[model samples]
Target: MGPGAGEVSWRHWICDARDGRLICPIDIPSFSWDMGIGDFGFSTTDKGAGKIDESGLTLPWAAIPASTPDERSAMLDSQRRAIVTTWAASDDPEDKGTPLFWGKITGRDDTWLDTSFGLESPMAILSSRYAVRDGAFKDGHSSDSIAFTGMSYRGICSELGRIATDGKQGGELPFDWTYTGERGSHDRTDYQAWNVQNLAVDQLLTNIANCQGGPDIAFRPYWADEQHIRVRFLAGSDADVYLDMDHSPVCLSSFPDGGSLEDIHVSYQDGYHRWYATGAGTDQGTLTCYVESMAPITQSMDPPVLREAVYGDTDTDNLDLLRRHVGGVAQNNSGKLMQITGSIDFGDTDQFGVPLHPLGSMWPGESVTLSIAGFPTLPDGDYGLRLMEMSGDQGSKADLKFDVLEAPFQ
Candidate 1:
């Protein structure tokens, strides 16, 4: 049973062995009050001696000696610190894999677990020490690649070249999960179609123009014709490809000309409804898919568009861009972007109100300038501005403005 019955939770503790000996070089750090699978918060409620041996932990207040209560409490506290550090380090570095010890891991994410694939993961020593493949520590030297739970990685990166790889990152590998664990829209469909056009993996393509497999399958992308999949081609050697077998059948269609629906039709192969493609790509080429529920090139939500720009030597161009943000931007996770699709130009008399394009689509990490033309050239002044969400989901306007300067682009 997981926690209660049959479900495995992300919160867990793992005992570890190194060279066949019990060591304090690994640990599981936990912080939960409801489910006590592993709850160690150095509580004033009960701080004392606890035995952590070959079997597992059995820490309780009565176990410590009265004469050394402070010392025992201090040791466990340090161990707790080490464990927290290890937990943070083991929690998915760049969402990739690494080889480092996370001695103790006790938490509640469902997909986290042990490894059978040779690929390494962060390890925890039940509640003692933690490890990550991150190399180097400041001052230029290798800190212990394996550290007791409560220590520090203050200077550990540069010193160790990242526990196993060139410390390009830190932490544990992401779970190789496909199921989103959530259902779709009002539609009862539990699955979604994914498309990676002209998908290239490791270093090989999965398509061959007008050709099927033969004795010498020159640059051929193989489809089972029965299974309807262009599986990873394993020739004289296991060719590298990233399309995992975990993929399931999902509808796929093509739009050769990005045309309307009536122009497209279903394709059949070997007399089975199981096969089809839109011939959406290059004529000789084919798209291999069992089903396709959505299109490959989806129209992104409209970003804020700049209507018109009037450039000049100074602030004399226009003073209206700041009058009122007629149409703002759309947003997902990485913050808002400007989109002025329905914006209106109030005419040259108030020409400044026209939304002129800034640096186009403002991506997550890019910055650009937005200017207005035809305003009284002045040293500095405050202008009125407003920001809004497209749907007005929040039902409130962000009443804000910024200071503008008359300084020309120098």
Candidate 2:
């Protein structure tokens, strides 16, 4: 009932080749009843309510094929996070302010086995392991509370804020607080007017969304005076990576130019690293804050951000120009680099994208792979590899356009 997972423990169902399981794990989010489209943010209805998984942008959702046994071992040994197939409570939707927890639902999105590789002898059996956990937060911080989870949309954070504002300490609910759903504005319209302590709900909402964009954007409280948090975008193919995080040069001075995860300390407690409140309001004891990660959606994730300069010739006629650009920004973070394992988007309608391999053709579904080792997939023509970087919502996202410059879609 306390805030935790792992200790409560559960069994990791071993996938069997004999039983025959085949699907791209990268496409789980598109089929996830809780995080995917159909179910939206609400829990499942039918006990076994299910949807065929469609390959979508890869963000390490539970949908990807469960990690290979070796990959699982390495993940636990390396990353502090563990892998598991999380789940949501399968009941009570119309309860209005009901809180739900996520468990047995780890992974990026879908958990399936890649059958095409035929790595496991075309019949090799691969499975993932699971260790039981206690004090799992999924069961709710307490029997009466729920764990922090992706709530679905960026614009509807008020649903979650409503709960934190009037938490069940037996106090009055926030029906009295002015509510508005304007884009980018904090959930409560009266956010600035609230007592200091009450600002927690508002600050938390912003912080959660900030976290999804990585360390580039700080999710701290906004004060009425002084400078506000400024944002910068580093463009990439299919996704946008943010660079500026309202950090001062003094703080950047301490950051190592190059180091492992262990060498960096971005201050998880401070506004940039972790979460914090803003605007020292006098009476309400300075609005406090607590934030969860941004809500899960089928949005494309920016991979490693890339930055580069360009030199080119322009056709000023009709602006029908052709140019040669050397390097652009990474799709994920802003580190000096030429290449990285990243993801971007074409558009909401163009979801088919995957890690480019050698000699492969286009396919149906949101997930795809282009293999070009010894064969041709793209049509013969001049194709432009244009990278984009956009900033908004105090963060940014991007897309990589691979189109024929002088031809039609083949």
Candidate 3:
């Protein structure tokens, strides 16, 4: 079964990020969210390739009531000290809402016809802190590199996440997270080490996740109550690839004759046969690892095409970590760069007037099936929902623009 079709309404609130307390409720006439699950690049040199999800919306000055000059000024501040909470509920009489977006304000547009603001996911907040050496605050060398030895990549990400949201730097963010899924072979090896120095928390996390055996990363927002908004950070080995047929099957098909589909694009990225990566240290002591693709095509080549690239991070001295990082690039890029993109109506209905797929039907990291008959070359079966953008206004259905990946079978 696919997502339920229905009508939904929205509500917006202005809130404090330090305490998740709602400051006031404002009617948001329209809004849009460009949510991303993970890195979309194929190169290893993409250092700051971490996903920085974002949203944009306009607010009229008259949306809120302010009795004093100070009150009005505080409500319009665009320094990201405050956050916006978006909620959606079925048009049912009960109106049980589901928190949709919780992002920190990063920019404003008072110069526009209506005051508009740009917002970013918690990653923007996480980018505020530098990955200082653990316990560097007590030591005089606060800028020295920090190292994690014998811990899994998941452990490293969790520790960094905690440090970013922990109140040590100042007040903590209104966020929480958990690490779920299988542990990799590098989870607890004494000889392995991961190091960081003076890098933003978000960048460092992305570097780790993009490594050979790194976990998939994603963020979600939740409404604890009418007065609070909470954000969650999710990371795991198989976090985004799981398939639950009962609830996860989202069937989207466009017949060759006619359908509401307006546009579609299919693109592919080149893959590399040989991969190499460098880690921390320099001179003769600098650590490095290399791997070649096992893909049949690469093996069948007469000269074995030497497509080489350097990917992953340079903060680790662990040879195992470096090997996995480069190997992952080869594994993922071995002729499997097919990506599909299109726009779909979240409120479309069948001849019987039944909703086809409603808003909130799918999310980043989930899988959806597309049977696009017009494109005969398009692969069949499920594809990973890499990114999804939902845009709409107060009383209408949303339009979703999505990017999906079809992994090449080994």
Candidate 4:
């Protein structure tokens, strides 16, 4: 008999990096994995050092009762020096398993006989590989120097793709990349000129992400199969696949009546109105630009606020680009944003006696609608939420968390 609905099946194996062999784990007990693709911003005393930090997926697993003591020892040895791969699939036969996560074993915690493994995606490898030397730009350049001026988003990503496939950096590694078209108006043209002298691949990517007026591009690298890797760039304004809450076969269950919202804050300040772009050339000078949002300033909120952000090492003096950047930052930081946390009912039946939405079909970055009662502050209509984090295990329901951004034009 085939596996029933809501039942999950998983495969855990230790992969040999040298010869590409797979060894299955023994007596796996429980597993939980978290995967996210987003931007993390950090600031310090240096105003120009702000960056858009990107992260890959992280999967940690636990095992119980090894087949033998020696078997456990071998697993530990492999965890120290071997690649690990995990595959997951629902009981539905039609569901031909998906390669959930794969990477080198970064860490492990072990008792006398039991063990757990910590894993990160291949992006970790790319982020760690830095330039050992530098060279001038030549025809078919093989060195690590930022060799482009006024490069478009596609151009920079294309160069990174070349480096990844050059057999020296990570080309020989098992990953494929797909660079989407420019999603933002500013990204269509050269937003800024890059002159990075010596930097790691991850650092260059971060610089590109921090480009003034650049779209929020996500570098998501995940397993395409047991061997192939798929790198995707999810950008702002790009049309995403929408998951309908009212019609989805997978039903979402809520707590405290349904869902709850908190952390609502709004602010306005002069710093958000002004943008300073510092150029990087001998003759290039600092450019100051200002923009104003038509939205009325809310004065009733307690604790008036002011937000100021600075972008350094930028080569663009375009007023339009600066205006776009300042406007987006102002709108995002000056409005009310909330967080909605809930769970999806994959194992239980709904009130109408129908199976809930299948948790197995969800992925990060997908849009979801929430329509529930019990929140007097929240409006009655459906609220759109973006899926940012998810956690689940076999034989139980999974949790879904979302970020609610203030709607523009409202």
What's each prediction's TM-score?
0.18, 0.16, 0.74, 0.60
Q: What is the C-alpha RMSD of each candidate to the true structure, in Å?
A: 27.4, 24.5, 7.0, 9.1
Give the alpha carbon lDDT tens digit for every residue of 110-209 in model 1: 1122201110112122112122332333344433323222211111211222222222352222211111122211111111112211111110111211
* Pairwise TM-score winner, candidates 1 and 3: 3
lDDT of 2 by residue, 367-398 (tens): 21222121122333222222111111100112
lDDT, residue 160, candidate 1: 20
lDDT over C-alpha atoms for residue 1 of model 3:
14
Local distance difference test, per candidate? 0.20, 0.21, 0.57, 0.44
Stretches of candidate 3 above 4 Å error?
Answer: 1-7, 38-60, 78-81, 85-96, 107-116, 131-135, 142-156, 167-169, 180-199, 237-247, 258-262, 282-286, 294-306, 350-354, 379-410
The lowest-lDDT stretch of 10 consecutive residues in candidate 1 is: 324-333
* lDDT by residue (tens digit), candidate 4, 51-81: 2112222222244324666765665563333
Among all candidates shown, the one with the greatest TM-score: 3
lDDT (0-100) at residue 232 of candidate 1?
18
Superior candidate under TM-score, 2 versus 4: 4
- Backbone collision count in every prediction? 77, 75, 3, 7
Candidate with better lDDT, 3 vs 4? 3
